[model samples]
Target: MKVIRIAAALLIGPDGRTLLVRKRGTQAFMQPGGKIDAGESAAVALVRELNEELGLIVDPTEAQFLGEFSAIAANEPGFEVNCQLYRLDVAQDVMPAAEIEEVVWVDAGGTDELHLAPLTRDSILPLYRSLQSA
Candidate 1:
């Protein structure tokens, strides 16, 4: 089995919604990031992925490290994904412009309605809940 390393962002708006993207041809809605390139730092990959997938330019200084998690690949079989997560402040008016089919804003309590990738549900959602309580 192949292991894939990915990076993702929990982009939070002032309204307290997190940005999620449903990729082309997939039912799952996940955080706005993707696979890390070879030799690229996780943070760097996250920034690049966000820009490519969502058309949002993230400042490295604004990204706060969340954690790392592992899960079975959401869209692939016989593979697993290790994800590095980050939290960042995002503008409310941003739009997704790449391979993303749709963009949705979800709050921690509403996660059940969105079909989420494993890492997003397992790792990132917990953080969102914690943030909501804080």
Candidate 2:
């Protein structure tokens, strides 16, 4: 199976809702970051993705490293995504830019009706739930 490595951000608001974005023409709503470029740390890639996708400015240092996760790609049948995940406590309002067609800030369990990328539905949501219960 082919794997696409990406750096993703679990951006949480002061209200405890996490930010999820849907790419144009894609049904799955996943975390906000994007592919990691060669020679770039995951944090740096996240910073660039945040700016490009959400029009938000995030310093690389502000990202709290979460860990790595893997799940089947929501949109690609044979590809998997290996994600380097990070969390940031931020409330900056986001607008869809670049390839993003829409945005939603919802609780972990709130997206059941929406198609979620495997990384978000599998690994990331469990981690978020664990944090909430703690």
Candidate 3:
């Protein structure tokens, strides 16, 4: 299987909902991030993606590394994403632009109406909930 190295972020709204986004023509709602580019650090890639995908500017200083998780890619077949995830406690007002089709904020355990990316359904949210319970 192919593996994609991506940098993803968990953005917490003031109301405590976690932000998720769907790309154009895609059904799964995942974190607002994308693949890391060549010669870019994970943090750099995350900052760039957040700007491109959600119109939000993220300072490298505000990112809290949440380690990495891997899961089958949600939008790709025979692929997996190794995600370098971060937690940012601040919520920048996000508008869907570029390739984003929609945005939703869901409780960590609540995804009843949304189709979640594999990294989100199987890895990120579970890890987040576990961290909260710790």
Best by TM-score: 2
Ranking of candidates on lDDT, top first? 2, 3, 1
Clashes of 2: 0
* Runs with alpha carbons beyond 4 Å of true place in candidate 3: none
RMSD of each: 1.2, 1.0, 1.2
- Which runs of model 1 end up more than 4 angstroms from their true locations? none
Candidate 3: deviation at residue 61, Å? 1.9
Task: Write the residue-wise lDDT of candidate 2 on 1-134 in tens digits.
Answer: 99988999999999998989999999999999999999998999999999999989988899999999998988889999999999998878897899999899888578878888889988998898788778
lDDT of each: 0.85, 0.91, 0.88
Which residue pairs in candidate 2 collide? Answer: none
Q: Can you give the lDDT of residue 2 in candidate 1?
A: 95
Q: Write the per-residue lDDT of candidate 3 for residues 93-121, one digit (tens) a residue.
A: 89898899999888866886778898898
How does candidate 1 fare on TM-score? 0.93
Clashes of each: 0, 0, 0
Best by lDDT: 2
Off by over 4 Å in 2: none
